[model samples]
Target: MPRRYLFYVEQNYCYGILRPIQNVLRSRGDEVAWLPVGDAFDRGGFEAGERVFDHVREAIAWSPCAVMVPGNFVPGFIPGIKVMVTHGLISEKRRKKDGVIYSFIERGLFDLYITHGPNTTTRWRQMADEAGYFEVAECGWPKLDPLFDGSLRRNASAGPVIYFASTFSPRLAAAPRLFDTVARLVAERDWQWRIQFHPKMPAAVTDRYRALSGDRLRVVDGHDTLQLLLDADVMLCDTSSIISEFALLQKPVVTYRNLSPRPYMIDVREPSAVGPALARALQRPPEVMRAVAEHARETHPWTDGRSSERVIEATDRLVESGLGHLRPKPRNRIRHWKMRRALRYYRLFPTR
Candidate 1:
C-alpha cells in the first residue's frame, strides 16, 4: 500500500534539510509531494516529479497521510498528522524571553517531533511527559547522511576553504559586523573563502558581501550550502545551528559572539580575533579537533548516515498504528485568524 507524504517547505534553504529524507521516502515506493508555502515556490528550486501544490487549501483537500515541516508554523486543523522535522539544530537559543528552550513542544502543533540526538530527545521526552501532545523520535539529522556515508569529501588540493555562514537574526548574525574584516582576510590569505547567508537575510546585507567577492572569494546566494559544507576545511559562523552541523565533520569552527551560554566552538568576540582563530584552526587542527568531536557527538551520534532510514521507519510505524489520525484538532478561532492573516500577507492565500 503506497502512502502519500507532503513536505511543507516555507523557505528555500530548507530544501537541503528535507531533500535527503524525501528521496528516502520516494525510494521506498511512497508518494511524496511538496507544499511550498508563501514565496517558497518562487525561491525554492523544486525538481520535476516532485509534485508541488499551488494552494494550501488544495493540499488540504488532498489530505495526504502526513505532512512534514521544518518550521514552527503549521495549520492545526488539517486532516493528516503534522510532523516537525526542524529546520536547524540550534535548540540552545530560546525563541521567547522567558528562557524556554523547547517551547515548540508546548505549542501542540506537531504530532511527531523528529529530534537529532539523545540530548534533544531527552528534552522532548520531558516535554511530552508534561503536555502529552506529541511523540518524539531520536533520529539523526537526515541532511548530514551524505557527509557521514563518505559520499561527500573535500579535495585537499583546493587549499584551505573557509566557509562563512550566519543566522538572519540581527542580534546574532556576524555578517553585518565582520564583513569588512572577512573581505580583508580573504584578500590577504592564500585560502579560498565562501560566504553563504541565511535565505531570510536582508538583500542589503547580502549585496554588501557580494561586492567583496573575487577570484578566491566566492559569495553564494543559492540554497546549496551542502556543497560549501563538503568543500570547506574550516567554518566561520555565529550563533547559527550550522556551527553544530559543520562540527560533525570533525573540522574546526570559529564562532563569533555565540548566543549559546556554553560555548561549543572557538569563541571570538571581536572581528580582529577571526584571523588568528582561522590560522590556529588550519595550522593546529588537532588542538581543537577533540572539542569539535565531542560537540558533534552531543549534537548527533548517528554518523553512519542512516538517519533517513530511521525517519522513514518511524513514519511508517506511526501511519501503520493509525496514530497519525489521533492528533488533536483544536478549535482556536484566534489562531486560525492569525494564520489566515499571515498567509494573506505572504500572498499564500486568496483574500476575501
Candidate 2:
C-alpha cells in the first residue's frame, strides 16, 4: 500500500509549497491529507479541530509514516515521525517564540527540520543544535519550482515592470518617511509599480496608498506572486524571503531597511539611506544595478531551482526510516540529563 501522509499549512499563502508537494506525492499514489492551521474560515472553509491536538494526532493515527508541517505547527503529541519545513530564514531574535515552541517539540518528537535553501540551512543549524535538534537537513525550498521553466521568464520587449512585494508590519507602517520615499518613487517612475501586500495588512492603509498612486500604482489581491516575479523587472522588498526568490531570477532588487514598528518576531534589514541615491544611480547607468544584482546572485545560491527535488528526496528518506521505525539509539542517562538542562537554559532567554 502507498504510505499515508499529513501536510500542515501554517496559512493559506503556504499553498506555494503545499500544492507542489501534493502534486508530486499524489502522482506517486501516496495518500496525503492537508491540514490548514491558520484562520481558514475567513478565506472560505473552516477546519474543525475537535481537540487542540486532534488535528495533528488524528493525522498521525491514520498510520502516516511521515508528517510535514511548517515552522509554526507544533507536533509535540504526535506519536510518529515528523518533519518541519521552514519558509523564512528567520534569525533567533526574530523567531524566539518558534524557537521556544520547537524546544518543546524537538525533544525526540521531530525527526528532521528542512530549511528553504542550503544557505538558510547553514545559517540555522547552529540554533537548531543549540535547541537540541540534531537531525537537520538542507533540503531546498520547494516553492520556487515554477520559476525554473524557460517560458515562465521570457522578458517583454517593453521591459518588465517593477514589483513591490510588500510586507507591511504595523511598526514599519508607522514610519512616515518610508511611505514618503516610496510615494516619491512611485510618482517619478514612468514604468508600472505593482504592490502586493501581505494579506494581514490593514485595508485602510492599502486604500490610502491606492489613492496616492493613481494609475501608476496598482494593488493586487489573491494573485500568484510567483507569476509576478517571473515577469517583474525588479523586485523591491524589505527583509522577505521574496528577496531570495528574486535573486533566483537574477533581477535587480532593492531592499528597504530603515522602517520602524517592525513585525512581531520577524527580523528585517534596514534599507540603505542611499535609496534615493540608488535611484539616481539607476538613472545614470546599468553599472550600479548590475553590481547589486551580482551581490544578490552570490548571496543566494539555490538558483538551479532544484530545491523541490531535494525536499522530496529528504522526505522520502524520512518516510522510509519512519516506516521501518529506525530512529537514533536511546541516549545514556547522563547525556539525556545534560540535554534536559540545556533546554531549560535556553528557555530562560526571552521568547518572541
Choose the strongest candidate by lDDT. Answer: 1
| Model 2 per-residue lDDT tens digits across residues 164-219 | 77675665432232566667666665666677877777777677667766566777
Question: What tens-digit string does per-residue lDDT give for candidate 1 at 1-352?
Answer: 7788888877775687788888888887888788787754454476777788776767777778888888887775445677888777755677566777642445656778898976687888887776565788989988888888887776564568999998888888899989889878977889898899887789898998888777788788787677788888889988877787888777788888887623347888999999998988886466578777777777799989888888877876776776533544345556666876765533332111
Query: Global CA lDDT of candidate 2, please?
Result: 0.55
lDDT of 1: 0.77
Error of 2 at 230 (Å): 1.6
Clashing pairs in 2: 116-141, 171-260, 171-261, 172-261, 256-271, 257-269, 257-270, 257-271
| Residue pairs in clash, model 1 | none
All candidates: TM-score: 0.89, 0.70
Off by over 4 Å in 2: 40-58, 89-109, 123-133, 150-160, 173-177, 212-214, 258-300, 323-352
Worst 10 residues of 1 by lDDT: 343-352
| Model 1: how far residue 297 lies from native, Å | 1.3
Residue 27 local lDDT, model 1? 84
